[model samples]
Target: MPYDVEKPDEQWRAELSPSEYAVLRQAATEPAFTGEYTDTRTEGVYSCRACGAELFTSGTKFESHCGWPSFYDPKDTDAVELVEDRSHGMVRTEVRCARCGSHLGHVFEGEGYPTPTDQRYCINSISLRLQPTDG
Candidate 1:
């Protein structure tokens, strides 16, 4: 899914914080562990607080200890878009919301974790909201 008509600057300002605007709208990343969801382990789907798009599930989370919220996979395959991130001094895959294009984080392969999926999705804490399911 692609982003729809953008909200006006005034409306965006009223809805989002400076950092939220920078990351969620402008595609910036907050520093590790400083975000709201890095240490969260609620039993729910993590959705886009801005648009309610399901991005992650609590089940895939692991204590990566990488200072950011880490996941092995997304809750839905269509929830995100991955692009080649050639920024900084390394090559990484930049992860974003497929619907709203929110800056989620980076995905790296082959970290040698003990899991079957040797992938680490180091994500921004501010980009997600825990919506616990009625189990």
Candidate 2:
């Protein structure tokens, strides 16, 4: 099927590669330490992989050791949406694109961090693109 940016299902497949689409749109998780942003220490903002919407920043990211990119808070409250995820026989808060409502990942609480926000935004690399700021 031809991918279309205007079409949710089609654009998702077209805009993202198979692996990116699977993890970003379908909420499928990549193997531990397999994500590109997992160990990223760059100084910049992280935008959506599917869309160029700013979500998190490098300052908000912390070493959660969860094999995924973890952030203490998001750059914007409306940049991402949250949904009730009931997959894998457990309830989780699913994160999505506020603009397109694309699945991003899950956020967890009590991650034991000392950021402005104590919450951990366990995001997927396929769901984000780090944009380094001016040096």
Candidate 3:
């Protein structure tokens, strides 16, 4: 369970804002439709807000109407780590930044989404830092 960018809780809290710490460190979900990246369509790469690790690209983003930003895939397979989550009366897959082990969000699959992966990486905007591509 050790991460490449391991830091003490105090350090993490010092670096992240209150909202970012809740979602990224404590795995709390932000209110639906409130995330900054929910409706963003600009070309960019989304990196981990806590660790600066590239996680997803705009090309893989889709409108899932699920209130959060949805990506069909990670920037790379190794960019994220998926773990089985059995909380809140449901079984789901939790996605985290591979480098820092900060929670990104849950990933759901096989719900008939019209995407190559048919999967939705439902991530919180507070968990990401978007770096827009230069045109």
Among all candidates shown, the one with the greatest lDDT: 3
In model 3, residue pairs whose N, Cα or C atoms come closer than 3 Å (at least 3 residues apart or on different chains), thus clashing, are none
Note the Cα lDDT for every prediction shown: 0.81, 0.82, 0.97
Ranking under TM-score, best-scoring first? 3, 2, 1
TM-score for each model: 0.88, 0.90, 0.98
RMSD of 2: 3.6
Candidate 2 lDDT at 4 equals 22
Model 2 TM-score relative to the real fold: 0.90
What lDDT tens digits, residue by residue, belong to model 1 across residues 1-135? 437535666776688888877878776888876877888877788887566789889999888888888899998887888988877889889988887777788888798876658999888888788888897
| lDDT pick, better of 2 and 3 | 3
RMSD versus native structure for model 1 = 2.0
Better-scoring candidate (TM-score), 1 or 3: 3
- For residues 34-114, write the lDDT of model 3, one tens digit per residue: 999999999999999999999999999999999999999999999999999999999999999999999999999999999
Superposed model 2: Cα runs more than 4 Å off: 1-6
Tell me model 2's lDDT, rounded to 2 decimals: 0.82
lDDT of 2 by residue, 39-112 (tens): 98999999887877888989889998989999977898877778899999999999887866667788888766
Runs off by more than 4 Å, candidate 1? 4-10
Clashes of each: 0, 0, 0
Best by TM-score: 3
